[model samples]
Target: MQIDAHQHYWDPARGDYGWLTPDLAALYRRFGPADLAPLRERAGIARTVVVQAAPTVDETRYLLGLARDDDSIAGVVGWVPLLDREAPALIAELARDAKFKGVRPMLQDLPDDDWIANPALAPAIEALIAHELAFDALVFARHIDALQSFASRYPSLRIVVDHGAKPPIVEGPAGWQPWADRIAKLARLPHVHCKLSGLATEAAPRWTEATLRPYVDHLLASFGPDRLMWGSDWPVLNLNGDYLLWHSIATTLLDVLTDAQRDAIFGGNAAAFYRLEV
Candidate 1:
């Protein structure tokens, strides 16, 4: 089963997406399963792991409600106020729904870079492991060290670094060292995985496959095919490129690997990592 492991569905009218502003003209609108269905069909994608766009619990429930009715949506990576005292209860409640596959803390947007490494969030982390849910880390290169520390602290937690830590591809090969080194260190943990998504948006607007090859190659080297999964990143993807373009580029980049290895990166890894029903 070919799975787009990370994607999103959002309605701006609901007024919860603080980052989805009018400035990002192309994506400042509602995007749901209907809009993505045809693209998925074209890409031979059987299912998708719809991730949360807004940080509110209301939005998480909204995505879960959508997943309940849509078979195309295999699971959802929602958000909870992890810092709150009631986080464990909220996580338990969300986990009651089979489609609630994981949680993403939006670490990149938070002011504290060390937030994930904080000891206070232990209860919430433990709750996720106890419930058998994964953790989708929405971070950047800056948070890799903290992420590594957190992953080490909770060895049982199944964590996937969303968008390969949103690498600095736009900065070109010259700026690749520390980010590459940091990612390699993070990948040393067996519990940590990564998604091959959102790189186009991080590259130049007219980015070619060559512009992204080095970063993609580094991720493959660091995490290996078994630890990597492909994601469309969708509407946010529209800011730089479309679903088909990103899909085609990713496919070409993985052509060097054997069919089984490519299959793992395309779908198997995501299914195993997210614990998706498909």
Candidate 2:
């Protein structure tokens, strides 16, 4: 049940990915299930959850198609305008499709505190939960309070905290104290889980396990093994290093934990958290 719980796919020329332009033009790499398959084989990843990168339902449906056709992709987490009046309809529409396991709104760009608290987002969120869907919190440290609010409001609905609350370790973990405190608060919420995926990318460029140790340790301690999962973040991690580099960093970091804890961090937790079919 080794699941890379958070990854995305996109055909840049085919659709509107507002975040795929300009400064990131170099990252417009052509990728899909075919590109990831070899990497999965090398890394021993039996399953993957293709998370949403596009801002439209078309991308969600596309990934669903991939899940139907590609064995590596066991589940999908996509995007939806949480505050849109059409959210419920949108969720219902995607629900019938059967591959979309959840939704994520890219709250990272939104103002820290109010993004997830949007008043009009309830209908869609409720619809998602009713349909047995999950929500991936793509938020930053400043938004930790809002994340807490979100988890409290939707206690029964599962929520995954992507990127370990996105601590700014480049400035030292101390700078992330308030955010860490808030994250610990969110961890206490039985519904919330954290992904141990992108910690290296968040640290200084020449990052190593020692440099990344604090953040990883804090999260595992805060979220606990049962609620923690791992993700590759993949091509995005190309920003830090190649896939093997990311894998090596994760492996070295977990060397000190027990086998069961390591298993949960790498696969077990993702299987349970995302309910992937392994």
Candidate 3:
């Protein structure tokens, strides 16, 4: 049961996607299950975790609604206002749905790197722990220190670092510093996991397998296969490369691992991390 750990389905008209503007013509329109169906089929992907593209409860609910009808969707990682006083109730409400697996706070867009570690978010964080829902940290290299502190503070909340903390692939080897070092520090936490996705879009426009190999090697060495998982980051991934191309590249990059290790990164780890039924 292969699972694409992270992906998204959104409509630009939804008004909640503040980041989706017309200038980014490649991904300014609507993208739904039907559009991903053929690609998933071709990649032999049986399930996917559709993550939140917008930071609204309405958009979360919209994705949940879509999940209700799409069996191919293994889980939905939606957004919730963690700082709001009413967040715990809202999280509890969302937790009622079997497909609502987790929440992402969109930390990457926030100005403060330490925003996620704020004490005021305790209530919502407690709710997530109580409900056994995961926390998807959509962060960059700069946020790793705060993320590490937060993970240490909680210790029990399941957290997955999206995009391997989104290393600066465009800068080549010169970009390796802080990101690689910080990611290694964060990986020391057993409860923390990471997604091997979004690197293609992070690289130069004409990225190749060789261009991304170093970062991939670092992640594999830091987290190992059991704590790492594969994700497409599709639709958004279309900006730099297609689903098949990324899949092919990931396949080639991970080909050196044993079959069991390869299987864990491609599917087993995500299933266990997300607690998916499959």
Candidate 4:
């Protein structure tokens, strides 16, 4: 089953997406399953994992409801306030739904870069590990040290690095070493996974394959196909490119690999990581 593992759906009317501002003109409107179905069909993606766009539990529940009915949505990586003292209870409550496959605490939005390393958050992390749910890490390069520490503390927890940790693409290939070093360090942990998603938005205007190939190659070398997965990043991807564009570039980057390796990066790894029924 071909899975676009990290897409999002949101309603501007919901008024909960604090980050969905007028500055992001293209993404300020509503995006629903109907809009995505055709794109997925065109891309030949049979299933997708809808991830959270807002940090509110209300939004998470909204996505869960969507997952319950949409056969195309294999699972959801929703959000909960992991730093909250009641996080474990909230995680337990949400996990009761078979469609609630994992949790993501919009760490990138949080002011503190070390938010994931808090000892106070241990119970919540442990709860996720106990439940065998995935943790979708929404972070940037600055959070790498904390992520490494967290991965060490919870050796069994399943973690997927979103957007290749949002590399400094605007700065060009010369600026890749710091992010590459950190990614290499994170990939050393067997429990962690990385996504080839969202990088198109990070590039300079009219970016080319040459702009992303370096970062993609570094990640492929670090984690290998079995530990890596691909995601459309969808509406947000519309900022710089579209599903087809990203897919085309990603496919080109993986073209040198054996078919099995390419299949693993595109679909198999996502199905296994998210425990999707597809």
Task: Estimate the TM-score of every prediction.
Answer: 0.98, 0.94, 0.99, 0.98
What is the overall TM-score of model 1 with all chains considered together?
Answer: 0.98
Q: Output the number of the lDDT-best candidate.
A: 3
Tell me the tens digit of each residue's lDDT in model 2 across 29-81: 66798888888878878888888887777888878988899888888998887
**Could you report the Cα RMSD, in angstroms, for every candidate shown?**
0.8, 1.7, 0.6, 1.0
* lDDT, model 2, position 122: 82
Error of 3 at 253 (Å): 0.5
Candidate 1 local lDDT, 1-278, one digit each (tens) = 89999999999999999988999899988899999999999999999999998889999999999999999999999999998999999999999999999999899999999988788899999999999999999898899999999999899999999998988888887678689999999999999999999999899889998999989998999999999999999989998899999999999999999999999988999888888999
Q: List the residue pairs that clash in candidate 1.
A: none
Give Cα-based local distance difference scores for all models.
0.93, 0.81, 0.95, 0.90
lDDT of 1 at 258: 100
Which tens-of-lDDT digit does each residue in 150-178 have in candidate 3? 99999889999999999999998888989
Error in Å for residue 30 of model 4: 0.6
* Ten-residue region with minimum lDDT total, candidate 2: 21-30
Candidate 4 runs further than 4 Å off: none
Lowest-lDDT window of 10 residues in candidate 1? 168-177
